[model samples]
Target: MPDPNSFLYNNMIKGFVDIGSYEDALTFYFQMLNNVYNRCNPNNFTFPFVLKACSKLTAFEEGKVVHGQVLKLGFSSDVYVETSLVDMYGSCREVVYSKLLFDRMCKRDVVAWNAILASYTQCGVMECAKGLFEEMPVRNVSSWTTMIGGYIQIGDSKEALECFYKMQKHGMKPDKLTIMTVLSAVADLGSLEIGKRVHEYMDTNKIEIDGYVGTALIDMYSKCGNIQKARKVFDGIRSKNISCYNAMISCFGIHGLGDEALRVFREVERTRIGVDDVTMIAVLTACSHSGLVDMGCEIFNLMRKDYGIEPKMEHYGCMVDLLGREGRLDEAMGLIESIEPDIVLLGTLAFACRIHGNVELGEELARRMSELDPTNSGLLVLKSNLYAVEGRWKEAAGVRRLMMDKGIRKKPGTSWIEINNVVHEFVAGDASHSHSKKIYSKLLELSERMKLCIPTTQRCQV
Candidate 1:
């Protein structure tokens, strides 16, 4: 056996990589490269760590140089080295390069297959991801998770659920990654029945729902429109991470309970949970929806002053909405002037201007919005409102005409009904069926009954 003391440096670097401290591993790698200590060839263990660091840092140029060195050093064909190169390229969104490396491998392993599958999934190649999953000689938990997550991204919740069932039937007991992937799929499907079943599975197996799994479950329930269930899972967890806090806050925001979301956010801050930019975004969005200008400003300032996170465009957009909703049109416009005006900020300002009867400013904002999104129906509709308010009926009609000429129509109003285990969506006058007559008769009867019970002026014309 190798003497332990003789391999101290190698062992130390391995420890760093194992714990995902890839940056530290690279520091050692460079030191060895410069002969700072006794020169050491990066063994199989060392190369993976270096590659991981390069992938994480998105140092594609460095990664290419490293790949060349691996080839020159006769480690190019090493399965581990090849797998890491594939991962590095995939992480960089160089899928073509990753595929080239994948094809060159003489012996393909489960990890190699999983890496390519995940590459396709992350790159938004859903069909390719599904094809790879079906073609893999051996599928691991990672492979299944990749396909499930890909389907979720494509908004094909039914396919994702089907893949989940198929994965289980293959006798693969899902680990934490698998559970997290399926939770998101179930969330997108908005199926509380499946979510409850997943909840039961976790309880029966006594799975430690503490980290990723806990956060995913909270997101699932929240997205399913069951904040109560999400809160229950959140409360049952023994320890919470920053992700858990972010998920719960997001849940509250989506449910229109912005105040409660802010309350949770404060508790998160008080408990010493690290608030990231994502956390700030969720809280800010909540404040915007609830028209909490002061709260939004305070949180935004805290994000910069305390957390040191620079406010990006999304943050500025939320602030504009918050201020605009409160009739602070001048303040919102001043903010846009002070910073880089994004489309969202401009649109919000336009909305405020329309509300406050400031046609000139509204028109200016509408021009900016049109530049950003040339044919946005919502923007044109708001501009038409401004024209209508100013007694420019012809201009308002011209705006609508322009919209029609551009093939952009107003989005129809939508309503949701959760029936059985699935959510059913309906639109007005969407009776393209043989029972249209009966449906219209029933609708008329209900309208008549409502009219009889209420005043004529209160009757719904639609």
Candidate 2:
């Protein structure tokens, strides 16, 4: 090799880091340090790429050595070098060290601020992130997007939406990343009205619906229960990628439109778009729900033999559900035994046993499940229901007493409904709504109407 301390070697290291060959970058960096002739030392330009490699590899020991080298070289005050060190520590999940480094900086810039802000966000300390965000001297689009993305990452979709609106109020136009992030939050919330407004804004601004944005719109519309709009968006995409097709297929699967999903799959095949594992899963799910057993079997076989896609556990689970729903208990049980045991798969089979009135198998499965999840009250409840259905009230009472003795209780189910761009949450049997009385009165009126209609139907039968 040429002199390891040469500028050529430095550029080569940078090239490797740029192309994501982090290990190669680190190798060159170490070779330069170990060189006996050591005439050329790493300058300000060299430390950032080496630090980036260490960060990418999470090599804390090497990173600490590099930090010492930077201090000895008297390049510690270089803004780029300091910013890179902060980013390196953050990426390695050593946020405290990153913060200490930041506090030691004699001057701060936007890049330095973003690095620490990202560190806090990445570590799931959003409260600290928000505090830093408020203290920032200057806010940019990146700053806003980071905060919004942090909320989304923590499953606080509501807060993400609020942040987006706040960004707009500050006269910041959202770029593609911001739009995609907010759309995802909108989908999770199922706020169709808000989603519609976002769509309208894009249209009014004449923003091009590229692949990423197009996929997000399709996903948002489909998840929000506006399938027609999803299809429209799908048609509008000039270049539909595999994800776009997958979204459309999944949309059909969720709506139980097996034929439509199959048709779309066929179209994908004709275009030679190369369907992936996700596509097969969607196909099998659709067939399962629509009771297309023979078609599902054909597709499953084709996926492995023709497409060379090995079936995952989820694929096996779908097949088990398909067979169980069709009352093919033996086949489902054999399939379950062939694979590793999973709680969800066992639960599905247990429920199927209850539905098909196979109390013996149900009891055995429930017993095995109890051993696996002894603290689960839902399993106990299922066992009790199974006994009660078979006229074994004594056993049912015993299961209930066991639950009481163990202090196990079922969690209340909660649901949400969106209206007028707002979401309302309710738990089972909850009467906390302001209009609870009016809601109950309307429900009673509907119940009385249904009761009167039932007697008229009996008179007609006579």
Candidate 3:
């Protein structure tokens, strides 16, 4: 035992990583390095396990030290070791480092290619990921799934669906992870038709609707405005996790079915499935959107009293929003003032003040916002609008002049619509669409027709 060799060190590291004890794994790797009496030189196997720990912990500095050892010990070109180094660097967000190691590899295996592909994808560089994906001699499910996930990460749901369908065209069957990633895209797009197709695919292939997938289905259906299907999927799941409950509660929340959300929360309490921070946030958000202020305040107290969970900034933000939405400006102000000032929480109250025509409080909030972030174009605009609403044209013009002097242009607002399964995205005053002329022509036609209806169409004016 005095001379624990490379084999012992590798096992120790692997065992710890398996149990999710990344810190312990690194500790053993260091111990093996410094073993005085019979110090063992790490072989090819030693580096991968050690590098894995570094990757999981995102310990970039520690991983760099391990890379030095790999180079010094002549295991730099070992396929497994090189791949692990690539993975470690990628996980640590050093895309350049991972690609450099990948480029230097003597023999490029699929695993090595996937590791680099993942690096680009994980960094949200989908263009590079796509180029690399096409160049690969072959790809497995992980490669395809990683690409799909990259598209989803950048909020390109249509592109994600295209990639998924292309994967099918390549005769590659999707694994569970791929399905889950695509479900998110469908949810975001609110593409009910495609979501139904995915559900059918799962049924045809007999894919189990396990905890994660069921939760995703619940979300997908809810977002797509099919709350009934979402509830059905929730009820059909044989066993439910806290996430499943949270999804169902959130689904009800989005639909403004506050009572239904409360029923699910009560069920979580009765079943004692254990409430975490996320559960509290979900329920509180439900209450906020549904205007259940009294219930929200009561449960907010339960965070520390019953759950032993200290309310964090997000919790306080939710309470502020809830109170603000109810036009309780004074109570909202007192609550936010009692905590450390958060610009977002303050903005929430400021917005409420503007909504309720509380110009005096809006002025105070404008001063606070400017103090917090002088360069915030949105706040500058908010302040100008608040002044204009109160007929303070001089002050409004002054605020606008300050914005121009600072060269701070307001960010353009954006919106999107889906037509024939294609999502068309547009920003304010955009005319870049391929069908822009046709779209505008049709809009003008509709506007002319709308005027013919006269005062009858007043409520539906373009």
Candidate 4:
């Protein structure tokens, strides 16, 4: 072949990138750099495409070299090139460098702002992302979605909802991705009312209930204890995919409807849909809860033999739970020893031993568990409770003493109730709420009413 010009090389690189052949794009880039005949210099278009290939390939070192080349070629100030650089560093998990590049930019369009915003969001730096978001003079759907997604990624579902509402207040219409992300946040928060409003909005706006959004809605309703609504949504979906089926099955499991869950599984098996590990886990959990040991075993074998889905630790734990609940302690123990030991599995067995009054086995498992996780206060509490139930007062006292000496204290249980879209949290024995006095007065009134209702001869001691 003859010496190729920059135009020819640029076109070749762009074509490879457009076709998703990232390796070939990078290869052509290097070829252009090392070609003795042409010595083709990369233009602005060439740099972004190459940087994109670097981002996709996660070739950080190569990306830096390209950065240096961009500086040497005096295209460092190009907004497109700079945006690509920010994206590459962000994809490589180098948020600090991405930020530095972003800060140096003299002029930034929405694209550049979104790129940097995503970088901070991906790195779990919500504060910086929020700061940038507030400072951005112009915002788009991607910007809002990125911020909302960042909040969700960090388990701040409430904040995600807040951001979504704020976006609405700004007159920004949520796109499909935004709605899907917000629905996920709603599910995590169990904000059933808010989820219903979102569903209403989707209906009002005529947004298509695609597979992804439908699955999210199913999850939200199921987790919020509205299984009937979840089933309605499931039925409404015309084209049910495997994910849709998985969500419905999981809903039945969570509600302890083992028969319904198994029924759904059988239906899926009859269809062309394939069951994966998640599907099997849900089935096993349902079986465990309902004491369907034989069914659980059959499904567990089918998972491995027919579906080619390997049992993970969660699957084994479910099986152990099933066997242990049935008073088949020996089988449970055998299963535990056959698989790799996990804290959850051991804890389940230890609890089972206590329930069955198998003090000797409980003691052995407790010892092993302490060795595995010495700092777990729950385990110590369980051990003490076990000893106390068996009338081993001295051993129970010793366990308490050890806990005190180690300064290990169990976390106080907390519960939350949401009303009018505001979540109120209460800790056990807490009186910190503003309405605590009113709450206590109401409780005392109820107690008095209960006392009056009971006859003196039948009255029980407090």
Off by over 4 Å in 1: 1-32, 36-41, 354-357, 373-378, 385-393, 407-416, 426-462
Instruction: List the RMSD of every prediction in angstroms.
Output: 4.2, 4.9, 4.0, 5.5
Give the poorly placed runs of model 2, Cα more than 4 Å off: 1-98, 105-107, 391-409, 441-462
lDDT score for candidate 4 against the true structure = 0.90
Candidate 1 residue lDDT tens string, 148-223:
8888887787788888899889887788887888888787767888888888887887778986799999999998
- The better-scoring model by lDDT among 1 and 2 is 2
lDDT of each: 0.83, 0.87, 0.90, 0.90
Residue 174, model 1, lDDT:
80
Across 352-439, the per-residue lDDT of candidate 4 in tens digits comes to 8888888888888888898999989989998998998788989999999999998999888987777888777788889999999998
Model 4 misplaced stretches (Cα beyond 4 Å)? 1-93, 105-107, 437-462
Better of 3 and 4 by TM-score: 3
Query: Could you tell me which residue pairs clash in candidate 1?
Result: none
Please give the distance, in angstroms, between residue 162's alpha carbon in candidate 1 and its true position after superposition: 1.5
- Taking the tens digit of each residue's C-alpha lDDT, what string does model 3 give over 1-462? 756787888898899999999999999988888885686778888888889999999999999999999989899889999999999999999999999999999999899999999899889998899899999998999999989988998888889999999999999999899999999999998888889999999999999998899999999999988999999999999889999999999999878888899999999999898988888888898999999999999999889989988998898888888998999999989988888977888888889888888989988988898898989888988898888778798999999999889899998998777678666787777899998889889989997887887776564422
| Candidate 4 or 1, higher lDDT | 4
- Candidate 3, pairs of clashing residues: none
lDDT of 1: 0.83
How does model 3 score by TM-score?
Answer: 0.86
